[model samples]
Target: MRLSIFAAALAAFALTANTADAQTRVTYKSAKSGSSYYQMGVQIAEAMKAAGDISVTIEESQGSVQNVMEAAVRGGDYVFTAPPALVGAARAGKGPFEARPSPKFAEIRALFPIPSLTMHFVARADEGIESLADLEGKTILLGKGSFGADEGAKYMTLFGLDGKVTVADAELSNAVGALKNGQIDAFVTAGSFPAPNVIEAAAGTGVTVISLTDEQVAETGRARLVIPAGTYAGQDSDIVTTSLPVVAYTSTAMDDDTAYALTKTFWEQKAALGEAARWWNGVDAALLDNITGQIHPGALKYYDEAGIAVPDTAR
Candidate 1:
């Protein structure tokens, strides 16, 4: 009897040690520090860490494009980025990924979608730039080495402004200065409503928030969004524009069980997370429609068990 008791205790100790060792540690790559996306990433990491099954760390990055590339290269276990940006990079193998095509991009899978980010076109009110058409034959500032540049280039092409407007690449602050000094007529950017830079620019100078017409939105294949009146100073009316869905993704390197656990933990604790950040309130299983990449099998399994329909494309 004494020997059996001792043996049982030893087996229990080994089981506990093995269970602890099995906990997966993963690093989540987020956007620049102090940004909304970064805060969301922090909350997600905290949630996963609290689950007692996974250990998580957050790493700040330049932006969506950088996050996607880093996650694809094994630099991060998961990444947060705009779905359109990742889809575009993977499909064309151009832009920031121009040097070499990343066929591995196909292996990247979507996990969840955050709130949509609206595309904002800010132009000098004094420059007679009232609408997207006014941007023609003008010099525009697109963010240097970021998705803004890619979107700007695409917008110009879709709107038939290519060759009519000269595209200048610059950081947001520099671009604001150029607009103030009359160096650039307009600038293109995308983010959550009431973006700080747009607010600052509106406070400093008279500017018009250009809206895309319905036709333009359809042609661009972007969702239509409206920035409510008074979202920013000097903006007295609603601004109509297009939006892109931001999403969290992981590569195939993440095993099915780990992915399922992470996905289940996230959804199960989503209400708590939403309380942590208002933006998280927008995260729902329904928004998974915006995910353009393949869905991780683990996530699909979770949704399947929950009876949530998984799109054929994602599967």
Candidate 2:
């Protein structure tokens, strides 16, 4: 009887050890510290902890380009975020990826999309600023050292409005007040849809978000995004804009089970994630069409079971 009891205790102890050893660990590399994407890493780490036994460690990266470069040699358990375009560039050995072409670039597989960087051009509707051309005679604010400023300046030059429109020299922090008081005719900002600054500007003044025409979008050679109607106050129509898709990816070195669990947990917790941060609300399975590489076999399993269609290129 004592032997039987001893055997049962040994079995129980073994099970406990096995369970403890089952935890999966992943290293997630993304943007530089203090950026919104970096904060997303912290949020994702917390979500994984709350969901199950998986553990995620956040690592800071210079940017997406660096992320793709590192994936060339990083082994299993390494995950990172980057725009799908970079993956394509890496595969073709063009652009920044031209310097180094590794077969490992071919092994990169997509997991899922996070929030994108969407452009928003807030303009005073009362000033007859309904389109890009309308900005030709308007005074606009393009905050210094920002994506919006740079892009706005480029578009003005591209569309022949550079010398026509006057740029206000003001900090972005005061953009809303300046717009409300008519100090500036419009201002350009880029971020995820439902951008807070745009929201505040819309509510405070009769402002409209600019929609880039198909011709203009194509000319600019950037991805397109359409913000649904009713996304903001005083905006009753779709706002077409530019989008830079950000994606999560891993190398084939990671086994199917670990990738599957990670992908499954993400989709399952996406709603909760959106509740935590509004930017997450912009993510949807449809964005998978933008992923450049094939989907991870493990992540594909969850997509199939969940009835989410996979793009042929991604499969």
C-alpha-based local distance difference test score of model 1: 0.78
Q: List residue ranges in candidate 1 displaced over 4 A.
A: 1-23, 31-39, 50-53, 60-106, 115-117, 124-130, 135-140, 160-170, 175-185, 202-207, 223-238, 267-286, 304-309
The sequence of per-residue lDDT tens digits that candidate 1 reaches over residues 1-315 is: 999999999999999999988888877776788877787778888898777788777888887777767655683256455565565676578777777667777778777676677688999988888888898888899876555667777988887887888887567668778888888889988776666678778888878999778888899887777777877777889888887877778878788887888888888879988777655654567677766657889988999998887678889
| Candidate 2 segments whose C-alpha is farther than 4 A from its true place | 1-20, 170-174
Q: Alpha-carbon error at 160 in model 1, in Å?
A: 4.6
Error of 2 at 174 (Å): 4.6
Query: lDDT (CA) for every model shown?
Result: 0.78, 0.88
TM-score of each: 0.68, 0.87
Highest TM-score model number = 2
Q: List the residue pairs that clash in candidate 2.
A: none
Output the lDDT of residue 92, model 1. Answer: 73
